[model samples]
Target: MVLSMPSPYKHPSTGVYWLKQRVPARLLAVAKGKSVTVTVDGMPCTVKLGDYIKVSLRTKTIAEAKQRANEAEAEFNRIWLSFENGPVKLTLKQITALAGEMYHAISAALEDDPGEAALWAQRRRERAEVGAKLKVSPAAALMIRPPSLEARLGSWVDGALKQHHLTVTPETYQRLLVEFDRAVGDVATLLERRSRGDYSPDAVAQRFPPVEIEQRVAAPKAAKAVGGDDPTTLTGLLAHKQRTQSKKDDTFDKYRGCLKNFIAFVGHEEVGRITKDDVRRWRDALIKRGLAKKTINDQYLTSLKVALNHGVKEFDLPTNVAANIRDERDAPAPTGSKGYSAEQAKTILQATFRGSSKNLEIPYQRALFWVPWICAYTGLRVTEVTQFRGRHLREENGIPYLLITPDDGSTKGKNAWTTGIHAHLIELGLLDMFRAIGDGPAFYTPYPEGTDLKSLSNHRAKSAGDKIADWVTDELGIAAPGDRPSHAWRHAFTTLSRTYKMDKEARDYMLGSRSQTDAREGYGDWSPEVVDAEINKLPRFDVEASDWRPSLELVPPRPLKSDLPPRRPLRVRKLRAKSA
Candidate 1:
């Protein structure tokens, strides 16, 4: 029981004290379809509720109220017609106010700061104007390949912007500029694709420079030699190893650093003159300088082996100098393993499936998360998965699978082993993704001709896997496991298969690795259907495929400048009020 406050003025008709109306009399009476005796300053004002009630009913007589309502509605119609006719004049101040309001709505839609909307709009407007004047879109400046340039490259740029929270660095800007030119050069090719009714930007970008793994550094002397040396000379044993391993130039740089450090420690002795003892000393020095034993060993052995092998292959040295140097067996093996646990992996997958809001932020992060997840669950190597073509996917006996064949001139190593489709791949929703990418070899990395995107994808995948592993470790408040890579997913699959007590032969077949045999082929007894069945038998990840849908405007707004009315000075009071 609450006490009621006394009113200063009493209702004219009602003998009881009444408070002021809580809502607009016409709104409450007319909109709600209820008739109520509303108190206007404690006066009993009877108003009809519902749409039929006029706002002027309280002040005007019945006849006058009806007439006024008709006039007001007519005035509204005139204003609307003027707007449609482009004669609804607005001042600069009015346009700015409307723009501010529009920015707020757009910012809300994008879930970003409203303040940034003005900046984005201004930049977009400027870009449009520039493009119109130049008769080219910013994309036209990019030198992307045909279909690939349009499809994969454009999407990659958008995803990079969103996921990495990245901006173009001077180096990146230069690269983009180079790609822009390459893409532009492909205009003729793009036009052909368009003629065939396939002018998609992603397709153009992807098609622009096809992958060529045979690119070689200049080395005239040792053309038949496996490897070469000469730190300053790009070719040598280091070059051979890079080509054999299908590794990127950066990998060569790592070799250069590690090799230079070792050679400097061992002095400038000729290749055959450097003994196994010197190799051990350099290895120890690398270990002393805080290098991982694995890294130190890899670098030391590769460089030394290159020099020794180069001597044997090119300079006719009797024996490899560092052939007898044994690796330290007890160097305290690497302990900091890195990878997501089952639960952590599941959590990350869930976050990705929920989808990210629009921003130049989380959407890209989701892509990074998604790519690795797809790799892990599918048992595909990072390179194989990233360089996958759409044509690789096929269905047989009512089951979908990925048939991995090396693209034309794109085979790795000497043997062109055609791997059967893994039925488990369908569970990852890659089938649909492949379908969306259209016909052709779908690439993980869209590289120019003569550029090995495989190497770049490998390096990027490794780094991205590390970052995700670090994030997982941090989130779980646990130390990282061994610096496991996306390849570890393949390892994990094999390990899991073994743990589940699968047959040794079956496990080998399922993993697509060769079993020990004189035939040097995959287990002969395994049929394609059997291999497919075994792959399908594996546990499926409870993850949804990412929705890479196009964002279409529900209601396209008229261009602000084009929609503007004739310039007019608004009333002084209205302008001042607007400022306030």
Candidate 2:
């Protein structure tokens, strides 16, 4: 007769249960709040109540938790089993292929596979040797996790207990790997491709965390103060020095670019160790790289100069390294002078008239041409040209004259002076220039408040001036002058004025020169009538004279020599007669 368990219970797998074992005496004898054990007659086994209940509830024999644990156990067991399974009994080709697959799996796990796949190939050879030495099939010699003895004895059990049905085909093995990977955790689609072995180690490494190189090339010894704690980096030092030196930002930027390229070439480590030879070699390379010799040389020189200067001021490196390093004829020389000759000035004026034939608002090209030309002809610097105003044009006793009142901050003194405008400028139809701009003193360009009487020392004005010069040279085939630029016009004016035998006082006044005499308030006392007479003599391009007049009165004529003014008592008198 079969002993049986009578119970109300739940199955772990199905959540339903049926009685299948005996309820031993010990289970019946179980006391309240205490576990008991019972023996089943005929079975000769004592079953504890807790064990019986557990057995009864888990009717299907495996709990869900147990199933998961079993799966994990089976997985680790499988990996170990692979080691034991004495290499699959197969042809050399088959074993060789499987060995390669296993190595790939190992590498994927380790993430350090070499490029040649040599590790996998080696495993295949080792396994083959083991099989030969054993003389039995390599499959038997190879260790393996064995099937259950009871399951092996019963073919039915053998088939039923199999946990996996994976066939080791190359594709199937790869799929098993991908599934195993995914089973652990879902991978990104990109990473999934790598899981499929469709990617290279580089491709995979790129997908995952990359090998970051923490080490970089050392930088040049920086120009920090000799005993400073800041680790010297060339770039940091240069930038610091740039701010410290009050160098123009653009100039600093240029120096920075050259330095960066040079440092990059020599590498950070060798930056401070650089020799003159290294620089020469680098310079040669720049030439070979198609850089103009002058451009390369200029860059090199600027960078070197900045670096040496920084060293002197900050790092206290050996005296200036750039002092003697000079570029030869291969390098372009500095710009000499920039101004238009008389012929070139005329061409520029003509171009201005042409370009401004239609528009009036901008008139930039026209202004560019005419403004500088006026300066050139009048011997005014570009700054003074910008400072000219409507009030400056006045008539003295029927002759057109220009009153040059220097601004409080003008390079010339704040004192005012009067100069005759050449009749030729009036004749040349330039009177309209004065008329177009109001008597209110201001630059042709709209500037912010307080810029009245301001000049062209600014970058924008200089750039515009350069472009105008280039246009005159290129478009009109003008022969431009060297050196002085708008300033040179003053020189020309002084030269021409002297050639024309214009009075020294009149020439100085016309050129806006500072007065030489302390006696005449420095604006030497020239009579308006005489100045007027001098101006009337000048030639012009036929501009009609306007009824403008000077507000200031003329200097009184010197007293006649015989009817001279009374003199004050002299400080030094003949020694008084000692007697009385």
Candidate 3:
């Protein structure tokens, strides 16, 4: 059966109607960082809107809900178009002709009474003033702040939409705004001419070609439209899986967000109605909105495929419509080396020597100072460096190394691995720093052992990574368009390792990377003594920033565990995966 959902969906259970749409990817960063005021439950409140704008229609009646939803969609389309930087698509001839319609109508209607000519003259002056302030064209000023012609424009825009027999494409909408204002001025001039005892066809409007409606093509061979109930829906699937799957909170959050965005993109909850073309078009929309290709592929597209494939298996659907929907990888690849230039690297490490404006806990402040240096020398991933505890920093056979394992928490790889600490790090009082850390986290506050340990470890590691990345970009000014600030050290390490001709397997072990092609590499031990020899091949960084200071005495001593508040008991969650 075809789904009988309201265009603005009326909830089957709660009877509330809603309009949910994803924010365009171009505006996502802005949306995330800015607060917006929205009306809620009859009261106004300021809130940060995320990826999707999910709002109640504020009416349960089907007809009213549908009307309001269309208006909301239209209004948001205009707002989104305003944010876009793409060029206006309509040709000059078509725009002038469209404006010509407005001119003729205004001229004929005002045959008996033309509003004072001075009123429109003042309107023209106001347009010039607004245009100057905004540093925009006169027509753009008209769109931004229409000079007293909004009431007259209401019917004309509606007529255009009806005449086109479709909603305005963003490009058309942008073009129309410019022409709309020009038309207003043109009509005022016609009225002025009529008042002066002269009535003649407008020479400028006469030259315009006929305004034509842009035709939109429909997708070919869309899937069979199907009804939606509870089981086949993404929200339903998420609830059922959460009961069984052992997923991290961050993973769950990511999937949940993807589901909401996918649903909004498709404009429905009926997963069975989803088509390859539907997913393809949605992918194109995301591309238009300027999402990064890797992000679109890895997070949005991958999660959507997972949801649909899961739905087909669990609900016995006909197929995974998006199963073969591939990536949008046609965009030009970014140019430049992934690693920072040597001078850029030196500048980054040097900036770390500059202290923070506000006081931070000793471990955290030092994390800013040392995370980059540790990554530079050890080739440790940012999370791996930030997540370490004093115990993880241990000496084996009088040689110091870092042990990354699931035993400490989660690792990028499932296995336990060790990489040797460089002699340079040891000479800089790394051992003394660990002595001060004393079994607690080196960069973040440590929770009592075994109490939410996994989550705490993950959270702190992510927090520390973000903190360092922000410090590098914001404070140190190491930002380039495509540079990964936190991950740059890893790239720099790889480049240096290549220059030194370090053994491939040894370098891979230091980077916590595994060999997928080689078989013999599986049998080796990268113990401290083994990797330390390879570690020495990489040269020391000779950074001489004026603010540089290397001292373990600067770090505050770790607080006594005895003085800490009483520990909370560990809360265990039971997870059982459903058998295939």
Candidate 4:
């Protein structure tokens, strides 16, 4: 039997000691939640820590409980202090003083005979650029992106933050960037001075006040003092939901992230103890963070409400506390369907024939040229378009169809079925492109190993889609907050199909939208010829992109994600604390 435990609270019936403490008041709101390393079955499991900390002493004796209690309490205080809003705000002069120190170190380092040839070559190029800018506008020279920025960026800033107990803001960071440029530029100017054989007294270096450094007091590590309680946490519910249900992996990831943030803001894991007030505080905090009201309501708030609603049924939650909490759109919903106009659609399609301005990879450049055309003709989500494999292209009774499903990558819905390949896409030599790529993902590869966010849900398809979207926005200059460039294709497809009087059921099938009224909708499959007929009726984009068609080897054999490096869950969890 265990001799001791934290004696703050005791199980009266079982006569076991426990430690129960209210979460510190200051950390009741947060921008995001962090993983707290916890232990279960002697294995380390990370949990979204909640509002109160309750630990079982696992000992019955008073003296032993007190000793454990002391240790637990000490560690708790240390972690709480770390999370609390840190150090007094740095004054403008003090901030300048910190930047001044960076100037001295950089100038002095370049003063002597430098080490490596490559380093000198790189630095010499950076130094030359600074020298040219200094000649034009010495004041503007420091405003250039800091060349010697990284050398002392961490040590100088970290030392000052710790010394004065300061937190840097974006505004302060902008100032520091200018100050660092000044430091590096001054070094460049000094080097030029030395080369000219005039060893003059350095005026700029003498102006900076020294950044004071102080000895730091190390605190007890959280893993050493931290312990876990086996209770239903908000994120734990999401895990259980994922295991039990058939839902989109991406959606689950989003919900998991939202609930973790909520739990962290409230400060604990005990679901029964959660209050509506706690959730309100979190929502209010999100609002203060200047998140768009739509984002706050749809993504953040809605996610919590959905998770808790499930927790009510599956995990025996008392009630869905966040059920009705929502941020009503602060402004009226913007009127207008998010679809490209005929002219805009043609422009976007025509531009695909031209080379990408961004240095896109071969596969991605192919996606840039083809995805919009495919999206224009087929109305497929950007992901569905990118997931194309040669085998996915099949002939049904002399009509070709592309398969849309989760077998390749994450798709939005369960409407996994054949979609007729528009004749327009075929006309653009899509078939040849598909054949050249072979039986492999046409647009993306398995994310390389050691990717920080490599997961079943956060796959490379999204990355491919994002690359296409960025090009459409930046190169095409089609950026609007209400309308997404990639997604607007869906709206345009629906509109054109309606205008052409294509069968609603065929249109719905192509879009993967579920038919709520008719149960027969899911029973039978659409003939590729029939769908192809309706697809042709919708009409093709009048613009030509034949020149943009791929001539290079488009895709290699399909990448095996299973062969890639295993997922490394914790870059941070591995930091000093693995398991307590």
List where candidate 3 sits over 4 angstroms from the true fold: 1-230, 239-249, 456-458, 517-519, 545-580
Provide the overall lDDT of each model, using Cα atoms, as 2-decimal numbers: 0.43, 0.44, 0.64, 0.64
lDDT of 1 by residue, 320-432 (tens): 76776645656775553234456645665555454334342222343344455555555555555545555666666775555544452222331233334444345445566
- Each candidate structure's TM-score, on Cα atoms with residue i matched to residue i, is 0.45, 0.35, 0.57, 0.61
lDDT per residue for candidate 2 within 436-483, as digits (tens), equals 555543333433335533232342334445555445544544445642
Give, for candidate 2, the lowest lDDT window spanning 10 residues.
206-215
Tell me the lDDT of model 1 at 330: 67
Residue-wise lDDT of candidate 3 within 1-580, one digit each (tens)? 1122236887788999987777777767745544333443334334346776666777888887865665455334433432332223456666667766677767668945776767766766776675466556554433443434445464565455433233444445545656776777666666766666566655545434466433322122333323222555666656555555666656767886776666654545566677786687667656755677887888888777777776777678678887777664786666877777788888777777775655666666878888888988877888778877778776878887888765555566445788877887887667778877577677776655554445542455667777777677656656633657877778888899999989888988767787878888888566778788899898888876453543344333333355578989744333221100
Which one is best on TM-score?
A: 4
44: Cα error in model 4, Å? 39
Residue 468 lDDT, candidate 2, scale 0-100? 51
Query: What are the RMSD figures for all models against the true structure?
Result: 30.7, 38.4, 18.5, 15.8
- Residue range 1-580, candidate 4, lDDT tens digits: 0112234667899888877665644565631243333222223233344666666666788777775665455334434433453433345556667777666666677656534445434665785675576578744443333335435454556543433334455345545555655566566666666655546787666446555322122221232111321225555566667767888778888886776566545445456777786677678767755678888999998888777787799657779988888776566666766798888888888888885877767778778877888888878888888866566888877888888876666665645777877787888888878877777766776343334322366666777888887777767776533548888998888889889998998888888886888999878768888888888897767775455465446444343567668987633211111111
C-alpha displacement of 574 in model 1, angstroms? 53
